[model samples]
Target chain A: MTEAVLAADDHALLKTQLSSALRRQKLSAFLLVAPLLIFVTATFIYPIAGMLERSTYSPEFALEMPRTAAALAPWDGTDVPGDEVFEALALDFKDSKTRQATGRLANLVNVELPGARGLIMKIGRGVDRLQPPYREALVALDNDWSKPEIWQALYGLSKAYTSRFYIAALDLKINRQGEITTQPEDKRIFLPLFLRTFWIGALVTLCCLLFGFPVAYWLSVLPMRYANLLMILVLLPFWTSLLVRTTAWIVLLQNQGVINSLLVWTGAISDSNRLSLIFNSVGTIIAMTHILLPFMILPLYSVMKTVPFSYMRAARSLGANQYTAFIRVYLPQTKPGVAAGCLLVFILSLGYYITPALVGGESGTLISNMIAYQVQKSLNWGLAAALSSLLLVGVLLLYWAYNRLAKVDGFKLG
Target chain B: MSLPVYARPWERLWYYSLRAFCIIVLLFLVMPVLVIIPLSFNAEPYFTFTEGMLKLDPAAFSLRWYRDVLENGMVNQDLPVASWAWLSDVWQNSQWVHSAKNSFSIAIGATLLSTLLGTLAALGLSQEAMPARRFIIALLISPIIVPVIVTSASMFFLFAKLGLTNNYLGIVVAHTVFGAPFVVITVTAAMAGFDRSLIRAGQMLGAGPLVIFLKIIMPLILPGVISGALFAFGTSFDEVVAVIFLADYEQRTIPRQMWAGIREQISPAILAVASILVCFSILLLMVMEVLRRRAERIRGVTPA
Candidate 1:
């Protein structure tokens, strides 16, 4: 009985020791990854989070119009703000004018309510010249001061954190009655731009697949030496400068370019009737398809290499025709490659900026170009953040789907 | 595949048509890039073929465009080409040269940083004891999947707030984030094929972990690490969006310079630069191919 008890004690001790060892191993493993995780978190993840936060966090109005925001906080949304709110606005405008921030304040308010910028600027310029009873003075300064919608816009935007920017991003706004509605037809843009971006991306992916499939098959079937030699043709462009390739397309596709010149020489078309191909959607599509075609071919080639010729031969012997044999035995085997290649091309084309910016004229410009315009030209950072967040969510969803369908860890660069 | 000597004319037609289609696709892939090389050597500052070029005249091709690349941004272009002043001017004040310097520095910095961190993380990930492996891998690779414009905008805001905008460190860090995914992918692949028994054998011979890794594992995975570094370098070299947001004029890179050139002007000088870059890419491609073959031979998949 004593011997049995000792053996049980020994077993328990061994279990504890093994468990401790495992814990140590896990700790060491985690320690190895900690540096990169922390670096990526700080440099990448944190920045993105801060950018997303900007969509809802605008402090310009609240900081410059603190008294007005405070005074209007208690006023319900049902009607125009009273005298105290106007007095607070007058005080804020006086301060902002002296600080030279009134213009910025006006721009901030204008983002939420069009035509309010001029009123704010006028009030800012005349705030000091006005006497007491500042409410009537402000109303006299602009008839817009009497409108409830303008006040509502100011009140909605006065908060340090508001969804005004997100609503604007969707091309919708909350009106005087606090109802969410679409912008007028002329002003609605983001939704269509998003759709156009996706459409262009899909078209580019399709073009790449059409061009890449036969080449990949040819490479896979060729002997090793010739296959390796032909692989360089794909990889050369893959490693070439993107701007260079785009420039090459411009050189080749311009009206006075090599292609048009060749066509004219061949009597296929008159020189006066040369096609206008560059600086449009056609140019964007052609250049992007060329650039991304290698991405499709590489994945497909790698996958196709693993498929044996015997399977097709077996299918053919079983009385299937060439097309039927290929469809039944060959196509299904290349599905993962197709999924990976298409997803990669589609996602990349969706985010393309340089090529589109260079070649995409007014009709071809994508949502990314608009986001860039908002950041650089419009200085509408809030809207840019909202658009970017939407894009991020879409990309993440696709990435998750890709992870499920094709393990990203299995991806090979070659 | 060779055409089967089938007893049908249709099969023969289909086989020939397929071959024709593949040849056309291959030509489509290679023609656009190859066409630029000859055009860059044109004597005239034109994108299209000049009459002299079409006639194959001796005066058609000149090194004038190549000279323009050297002279375009020199502070003292009037100085004689062989003079020390001219060399220094080109080194210090030539826009393309300055951008090339910036590109190399940033690419090297980013490559070293990403390769170090990513290789370490990959080593940890290859171990069975690693926790939350898939989630961590996903996070590490997210930078490559996220739209670069989004990443640039976010980095702009963060860097602006931190006063890191217009700073080299900011660009380097952004590039490291971008390049780390390639390193992780490459190193992880190398480690996946690793023979764990070799590591155990070294340990059983009474070697310390550091000695075993340096002597046994490092050499085995060096090709993967080098390829990853090349990828990281290429990514940093080619990147421009982040530079647009985070870099000041002083921090301009090759792609940024090219972007401005393409947007503002189309010159043969740009083509000259493009030709040089194409040559550089070819060199890199050859190096990578040779390394890949060497790696295969080392792994005993091919005869040495």
Candidate 2:
């Protein structure tokens, strides 16, 4: 009985020791990845979160013109707000810090209210000489100040957490009746741009597949010596600078460029009938397909390498014709690679900025180009963020499908 | 592909046509880069080949465009090429030189940062005991998968808030985030080939973790690590969108300058820069090919 108790005690001691060692191993492993994990989170995740936050969060007008926003907040939007709201606006305009600050507030409001910027600025310019009853004076300074749409739009901008940017991104706005309505026809670019972006992405992916399949099959069937050499032809461009490749396309495809010159010289077409190749959706698709063709080929080639040739021989021996052997037998085995490559190229093309922006002229621009314009030119970051979020969601959804359907081990590239 | 004796004439025709189609596709892939090299050397200010160039006249192939690459932004263009003032002016005032410096410095900083952190993370990830490995792997590599515009736009907010935009360190950090994934991929691939028995033997022999890593794991993974670094360097060097969003004029890189040149004016000086960059990439590709072959040959060898 004493010996049995001693054995039990030793067993408990060993169990505790083993558990502690396992814990140490886990801890050390966590410690190893912790630095990079934290770095990615800080620089990558945090910024993306901040971008999402920016789309829904614009407190500039509300915080900058606090009393006016607060006073304008409670109106039911049935009509023009009372004199109290007008007095608050007059005071806020008069007491605002700088001309730029007033302009900034006016700009934000004008995005929703249309004519509010000039009206607000007019009232601000003429406010110093205004009388005690500020409502009459404010409306007199600019007749637009009395409009219910202006007041309603101001109320919408007052909230710290807003849907205005997202609404605008969807090409909708809060009408005077305070219900969401479609943007005026000319302002309806984002939704259409998003659609066009997807269309371009699909078209480019189709092009890549059509071109890539033959090359990948050729590489897979070739001897290792020639395959390796030709693989460099594919990869050198892959490794070349994106700008360099883009420059090459521009040089080759412009109206006065190499391809057109050769065509004109060969009498294939009249000199006046030069093809407009670059700066259009056609160019966007062509350049993008060229840029992304290797992405499709690489995955297809790797997968095809593993597929045995005996399957083809077997199918042929079973009285199938060559085309039937390929279609019935060979193609089925490459579905996973096809899916992976298609999804990859499609996902990549959706977010393309530089290639599309450079080659894509007025009609050929993608949603990403519009987002860039919003950020850099218009300075409408909120709308930019919202549009980006839409694209991001689409990409993430496709990626989720890729994970489920393709069974991707990890994202591998050279 | 060798034909079987049972092949018919139609089958032979189909096979040759397929060969022709692939060769044409191959031309489509390579013709653009090849076409640029000859046009970049044009004596005239035209993008298309001149008649003289076609005729192989020496007058049509002056290195003037290459000279223009050096002298485009020189403050004193009239100074003699052999003079010290001209050389110094080229160094200080040339637009391409400044961009080249910016690209190299940024690429190097990103390479060092990525290679170090990525190698460490890869080591942890290669181990079986790592917690939430799949999720972590997905997160770490998400930068590449995420649209760059979103990433750049996203990072713009952070950098703007932190006052990190308009600085080299910000671009460096941005590139490091991008390049770290390649390091992770390559190093993990190398570790996947490593023999667990060797590491176990080290443990059995009472060698410490650091000692085993230094003596065994390091040697095996060194080629992978170096190639990964090159890939990282190449990535940062070639990247433009981030630089477009994050960098100001003083921090412009070669690709950005090329972008402006292509957009605003079509100059063969830009093409000269392109040729130089092409040579540089060929050098990088050669090195990578050698390293890849070495890694394959070394994959399953047991360390003595």
Candidate 3:
């Protein structure tokens, strides 16, 4: 039978035609795609790479005060060895104000030792002294100031650019006084916060999936005209502003809002009831679930639409009950939608800032909230970049993991 | 085994219950946005019951807030008295726009740059020529995945040295970067349904690559191009962080201004602006749908 089928296939002509068409297609595609390649390279790739370089490359210590950095480059930590190093430091300091260079210098030294700030400040204070032992005086103001550790800090800061910020973000500290250490156990808050962010995101995504799946299934099975109208309702939130949606939630969930009023009127709760729903983690979960439910529903409905009714009927006819048929057969078929919806919700929730910031009290804030505070309020770009890098890595890892699972499971989400 | 009448009764009950449940879900989803349209005209800006309020207070129907926003020109009048108060005089000291002209200029410039980059990306991506296309596409659009805060934080120092910070160009560049990925995604989807034969035919007809792009490819993907442009415009218009970090005194966009307004004062003016934006987005969504349908017709794909 196979041989008979193969004999009728006309394979040679098909191969020849397919090969020629594909090559022609490839060349045409490359030509058409060139401009976009160049544009992405310049705008997307170049600028971000430039940003990474700017953050990691220490130019203050290495680029601006090269000669001074060179002079201190060879000094071992044992002694206050070279006058030339001190002279170079003084010259760099004299040419610049305490404001411009000193703060950056402090940041570099800060990587190694927490007390480096005071040491650097003392050095700045002694810069104007006209004494015989001025170098010794500056170094003696803090004994560690002359230690190779201080020089390293100065040299590090002087180079003006490095990945020290990135290092600090991971909660690792460097020091001449001590080896790089995990931030003191008490101060190590970010890791916990990062985990909390993931937990919250996962919970919200789960809530959305649970609430959306049944509704999407029902919607998909509806008559076409009714489904279209219902789908519009599902999508109406997309037309509303995000700010408005969040603000509405805030109002609705508040103590004096319609929800509480209704509860009181129906005698579901006391008239004196004062609920604390809007400012806590529960509020964050509820609001996010509401906002993201449609993301889950859309994917589910799209997938469920293509699911043939025969599959379930076949399972049922095979002596399986309706519940068993759905659990074993229909659920597996909905995997693609489940994956897509979960991915969308998880990814979006990971980066969510505005809603959590507005509604989330201390317990509800996510990694995005911390990142915002670092940039806008604290003005700590290095730490912000560090935290952001962590979040980025996390998101990429989750995406990669999901894609790998999909590949292994033979699940293709459109 | 059961009679049809007995079995049919249970089915009817199930169907009715399902329909009722679906209707309730629909009502929950649509009510919020529909509520706002009428509430925008409400004398009270608060999201409370308005029928009784509107009936008792005819003065509330007066477009006083809208008039105040337009005539007082408050959006252009003072720097929002918060973190942005320091930036109130930025234009006098720099080339930033203190007027609506500046906002228009920045949005337009960012939109153009982003659209060009994004459309090209979409076309390239649609062709599927590059090695490891999925991986490359993912990386290329990774900006959207990297939260905006991270991008802004990283760009702050980079732009500062490029002398792009605190200037119009700086804000525009930041906006362009943020907007490009959305453009890429939308345009790429549009190009996915596009036929490759037309471009091949153009090439065979002796048109140069650029000519084929302008005369053949562009017209075919024009809807995608337009969609990308609209997305880019919205992205820039709505961006807050990168502009907040990169722009100094002169380059405040509407969102940046709004952020300050929210923190510093309780102005109803923001609601007016937001109402306008809601209208704009709806109008824009309509246009995108029309273009999408037109593109489908050109490609000879049956409309759903």
Candidate 4:
């Protein structure tokens, strides 16, 4: 009985130690992973969150021209209100050179607000500093400072968070009636550019697949010794600058380029170098496909390397023709690689900026180019952020869709 | 098959034709870069037909353009003063050199930091005790999935607000953000086939964690680390969009400088610069391939 009691005591001791050990393991894992986790969160997650925040960022026009914005808030949009709102706005306008500030507010009102340019010009010429004349001029325009439409606009602009940027990006707007409506017919098509961007990306991906697949297959079938040598040929361009490659295409495809000269020399075309290849869709595709071809081939080759030849040979021995044997046996095995290559090419094509910007001229520009112009030229960070967020969301959705499809297809690529 | 004579003359002809077509395609792929290298050395600036297109021209070589580029002083577009006084006074300015330094600094800082972190993460991940390993793996590589442009734009606003956009630390941090994913991939791959007991043996010998890492783990995974560093350097060197938006004049990188040059003008100077950049990247790639082969040898993958 004493020995049994001792054994029970030993079991109790072991249980206590085991539980503590388990807890320590958990703590250790948390410690090990914590630095990386926090780093990612602080550097990546936080920055993206801040970007989303900037999308809704609004300049404090209310603080600067409170009297004007307040006085105008109660006025109706269709008819001019009591003179106080206008007077206050005019006073503020006279008192301040708020082109940068007021232009943002105007964009909130309408991106291309009529007379807003004049407002900027007036402010630029009139307001050297905040003075009595400026205030007096503002007070003389109108008195009612609480017009609903004006307040709505101001309120929309006041918050550091609002859907206005995204709404504007989609070519829709909040009407004076406080309802979202389609933009004017001519202006109702912001989404078309986005659609066009996707269309171009898809077309480029298709082109790469069409061109890349056969070459990749040929490389796969070639002797290993020769294939390795040829693979270097594919990779040689990667050593060159992307700009150099794109510019080389520009040199080759231009109207007075080697292609034109050769075609004319061969009598393939008439004397006139009629083809305007540069600064067109054809140039954009040709350059981008050439640049991205390796991306497709590499993934396909990696997949093909592991596939056994016996599967095809077995199918052939079963009375299938060579084409049928290859298709039935070899092709099924390559689906995963093909999907991976297509996804890589397609997704990469979506973010292309330089090629499209350089080669596409007016019509071939992608969404990224527009975003760049907005940031650098127009100085429209909010709109740029909103558009980028759309793109980010679009890419994320695509990745998610690809993950789902890849799982179903059982294809894998790093 | 030989006894049956299943293949006809036309079939053999078709196969041979296909092979020839493949050869031509291979030649097409190889010719462009080959053409550019020689063109870069041509005495004449234009890319017209060479004197001996099929035959080698020993006398046609000239370093005049390269010398002109190196000897001429670089002047600021905004200000006419010499950028750098040495050689052509252009080299006297710190713009190109400073930017190159920044790129190197950021790339090296990012690569070293990420490689260390990735190695540790890989060790922790390889251990079965780690919870949610698959989820963590996915999250770590999420940057590879997100489009770089969006990342750059998003980071631009974030950094500008934080006053980090134009700073060296900011660029390092941005580079590190992208660089970590590559390290994780390569180092994880290296560790995938690594033996666990070698580390355990070190532990049993009373070696500390740091000691084991240095003495045992690092040697085994050094190739992956090196390759990851090469990739990081190349990425930071070639990266333009982020650097363009984030950097001002003081922080402009080489790629950014080249990009501006390209957009604004076409010059033989750019060709010289391109050739230089190409040489640098190829050197890095060659070093990487050597290290990779060494790593494979360590892992018992026989070299072809």
Candidate 5:
């Protein structure tokens, strides 16, 4: 102590320096990751936020027809607007026609008022002849122009931010009373499509498990040389192009294709009755199951590889048969693997786009295909965004569950 | 595992049946990929095996489809071999060739980007002093977890607004988001068993951080980074969803062209492309296997 005793203030200052060093290390580590975080925000996260905004904040009509919107804004919406509002609408329609913005305005209105697209386009087409005394003249062009309901629908479209697209996504409608209600029986497509999607996902997951279990067990129990060779089979499929596999399935499942050809040649089935396989649920299930089978096997094999062989032998010595040892003794230990594989396959099948789009025709199409239809064919980006957002929620929830079970640091891709 | 001589007839039956079941399952996994290779050589423009093909007649196989890939868009395909004009025409206008060029360029660009960003983040996350490690890792990996359609559609909207759509750069950036997760996962996995004492040793030996990284750490993690790069390449190469949503006709990639071929008509030309892609994937698979084995040998001193 007499040689080099530090003062009390100096000791406190050293402690402060040590803690500051630790904090500096933490800060440096965080800074290393910051570039990627910032990059992802700009490229990915911001876009997703923008699309969600599109679902509710579409201003196609309100932005294009301001005068009409303002005139309609004061009405109670219980009845059609008077001539003053109609004059504003007629003039706005004329301006929108000249600006080439009527198509968008009509498309927005058509989302709320079904079968109104042709009427609005027709009105826009003939807007040059649309004279004043506008209410009677507009109503004379089409009875629907005078109906309080159509006007009320158009009034809803007048707003910049609305929830109508989301309502339509749920297969619901907004009536003249401005209340949420179910779509008529024939119009309810999405809810049923979503249920079918989940149903198909479960089916595919079950199929993967059925095929994957024995194969995974075989790979796990075998010696390393043999196990590694067999694993290549699984990995090859995992690495193959999705379109290639889908094309292969098409070649195998088409009526003039391999399986049917072989079946007919072997006299197992008549040429007149070649199986209807490629363009239906059967093709989708079979193709998806084959494509996803390796996903199930890889995880199961990884888990089973760690299980000691002695446990099954002990179960056998304790008066259990091979089947009982496997069912009771072995499988219980592989629960996490089972859960992981099922959840992974199910999650994948739910959001599957290529296989289903290629092989799943009509009744076989899932919710993903419907979203594609909205984007490409129907040109309903608002409804498409809404549906995708819902799908995102479901997938995210399942993903969170999978993380809890697998506890994988990050997902391993083949 | 081989069957033990328990001397039970039922157990013998069970063992044989299980083996048979597993063989069929393995066949299911491997056959679809192999099935196309032979079909691609069909002399007839048919997907199914003709009688001659089944009999392995020499005349039943042709390279017409492969020839088609090169000749489909060439202005003067009949020009003599080794002609520069014909070659340039093929390079510029051949549907499959042009798409292939675009595919490789996009894949390479995306792979480089994702590998750089993902490896850095993975390294930072591995640091003992890293804060909120789990949450940051989850956020980075969410790109993989999210559905491709949602990602594609979302990016389409934003990129449209920013004037980033219909260009190779936009596609590259979108694909990097998809590709980054693979790089991050593989690199993080490789670093999980990394020894920290080596870093201290390097420092004590009077080495700088950059020197130690390049001379020591890079060697150990190169295989991981390489495998991750391959994964990223494959992810971008195999992707068609983003292409469908984001790219115009001018920026078509292989998968985009393939999608059109499938939808417009089922063509043997597609089979040719599929055959090429399958072989490419096999090469990729072999490289990955090599990297995995290298990693194993490197980690011999560590816990499995």
Candidate 6:
């Protein structure tokens, strides 16, 4: 009995020792990963989250007009606030003028209610001259103050956090009755831009697939020596500078460029009848297709390399024609690569800025270019953040779908 | 690839047509890039072949564009003296030279930081005991997959808040994040075919973990690490969007200069820069190819 108890004790000790070893190994693994994980979090993920937070975190009015903001806080947002709110706003505007912050406040309010910037700024310059029937004086200052929508917008802006930017991002606005509705037809821009971005992205992806599949097939079927040499043809451009490639496309596709010159010299068209290719949708589509073609071809080639040629031969022997053998027997095996390539191309094209900004004229400008314009030119950071957050979510969803469906981890670059 | 003896004429025609179609596609891929080389040498400031160029006249070609690359942004271009003073003036005063310096410094910084962190993480990730490997890998690689505009916008807002806008450190950090994924991918690929038993053998010979790593594992994976570093360098070199959002005049890079040049005017000087960059890319591509082959040989992947 003592020996049996001792044996059990030994077994227990062994189990504990083994678990401790396992724990040690796991700890070491985590320790190895900790530096990169922390670095990525600090540099990449945190900044993105902070930026997305801006979509809901507009406190400009609250910061600039503290008294008015405090006064409107407890007031229900059903209708316009009472005279006290107007008195607070008038006082705040006077202070804001002295501080030279009225422009900022006007800009903030203008985002929610268009034409409010001019009215607010006009009233701000003359606000100190008004006598103390504050409501009547403020309303008289700008008849726009009579609209309950302005008050509702002010109340919404008074909050530390609001979804106003997101609403605007969707090209919608809140009515005087606090109902969500589409922006007036003249102001609606984002939805159409989004549609155009996706449409261009889809076309580019389609073009890449059409061009890449045959090249990938040829590469995969060739002898290794010849195939390796040919692979460089694909990869050289893949590794080339993006600006170089875009510039090359410009040199090739412009009005006085190579393609037009060649066509004219060959009597395909007159010099006066040269094609308008660059600075339009055609240029964007063409350049993007060229740029993204290698992405499609590399993945397709890798997948095709794994598919044995005998499958098509067997189909042929079973009385299938060449096209049937290709479509039925060969193409299905390459679905993963096709899915991966298309998703990669589509996602990349959606966010393309440089090519579009360079080649895509006003008619072809994408949503990304619009976001860039807002960030840099318009200084509408809140709206930019809202738009970016939507794009981020869309990209992540597609990435998740790609991970689930195409297993992009298996993808390799040559 | 081999036509069967029983093949019909239509089948033969289809096969030959497919081959022809592929050749056209390949030409499409290569022609644009090749056209730029000759255009960069054009005496005339034109994008197309001049009559003299088409006729192969010597007068049609000139090194004028290449000279413009050096002289365009120089402070004292007409300084007739071709001495060290002239060289120093170009180095210190030329805009392109300054941008090139900025690009190199940033690319080097980003590549070093990314390679170190990514290599360590790849080592961890390849281990069986690592927790949440898939989730971790996805997180690391998300920077690469995320749209650059979104990333740039986010970084812009955050950097503006942090006083990091127009800051070199901010751009460096941003580039490091962008570069880390390539390091992870290449290092992990190298580790995939690694023989753990070699490590064990070293340990059995009384070598410490560090010693084993240095003696056995490092040599096996150095090729991958080098290739990854090159990729990281290329990424930083080619990047412009982040520079647009984060950089000021002081941090203007090669791509940023190119962007401004393209936007303002398409000069032959820009073509010269493009040609130089193409040559650089070719060098990098060759190096990567050589390293890849060496790695395959080391891993015994050849079908000998």
Q: Give the number of the best model, judged by DockQ.
A: 6
Please report, as a value between 0 and 1, the fraction of native contacts recovered by candidate 1. 0.71
Instruction: List the global CA lDDT of all models.
Output: 0.89, 0.87, 0.67, 0.69, 0.89, 0.88
Residue-wise C-alpha lDDT for candidate 6, range A306-328, written one tens digit per residue: 99999998998999988899899
Tens-digit lDDT track of model 4 for B1-304: 1113577677677667766766665565555545555556667666533565335676676676565555443454344343433434544554555556676777788777776676667666666677877677767766766777777888887788789887777777777777777777777777776898998999999999899988998899888777776666666667778887788877787777777766787655656666667677567657765786687789887634
Cα error of candidate 6 at position B136, Å = 0.6
lDDT (Cα, 0-100) at A146 in candidate 1: 83
Instruction: Point out where model 1 deviates above 4 Å.
Output: A1-7, A74-79, A114-116
B-chain TM-score of model 3: 0.78
| Candidate with better lDDT, 4 vs 6 | 6
List of clashing residue pairs for candidate 6: none
Q: Could you arrange the candidates by DockQ from highest to lowest?
A: 6, 1, 5, 2, 4, 3
Write the residue-wise lDDT of candidate 2 on A123-155 in tens digits.
657767888798888767777777777777778
DockQ of each: 0.70, 0.59, 0.28, 0.40, 0.69, 0.76
Chain A TM-score values for every predicted structure, listed in order: 0.94, 0.94, 0.79, 0.80, 0.93, 0.93
lDDT for B172 in candidate 4 is: 73
B1-304 per-residue lDDT for model 1 (tens digits): 7778763898888878888998888888889988999999999888878889989998999999888777778866689886898888888878888899999999999999999999999999889999999999999999998999999999998899899999999999999999999999999999988999999999999999999999999999989999998889889988999999999999999889988998998888888888888888888889889988878988898631
Which lDDT tens digits does candidate 3 get at residues B100-135?
Answer: 456678889989988887776667667755445666
* Poorest lDDT segment (10 consecutive residues) of candidate 4 chain B: B76-85
Best-to-worst order by lDDT is 1, 5, 6, 2, 4, 3
Error of 1 at A57 (Å): 2.2
TM-score of each: 0.97, 0.96, 0.78, 0.85, 0.96, 0.96
Native contacts, share recovered per candidate: 0.71, 0.67, 0.34, 0.34, 0.75, 0.76
Q: Provide the global lDDT of candidate 4 against the true structure.
A: 0.69
Pick out the ten consecutive residues of candidate 1 chain A with the lowest summed lDDT: A107-116
Worst 10 residues of 5 chain A by lDDT: A1-10
Per residue, candidate 6 scores C-alpha lDDT tens digits across B1-304 of: 6677898999889878988988898888877877798889999999888999989999999999887777666777778545887788878888889999999999999999999999999999889899888888889988988999999888888788889989889999999999999999888888888899988888889999999888898999899899889989999999999999999989999999999999998898888899899899989999998997898788777732
DockQ of 2: 0.59
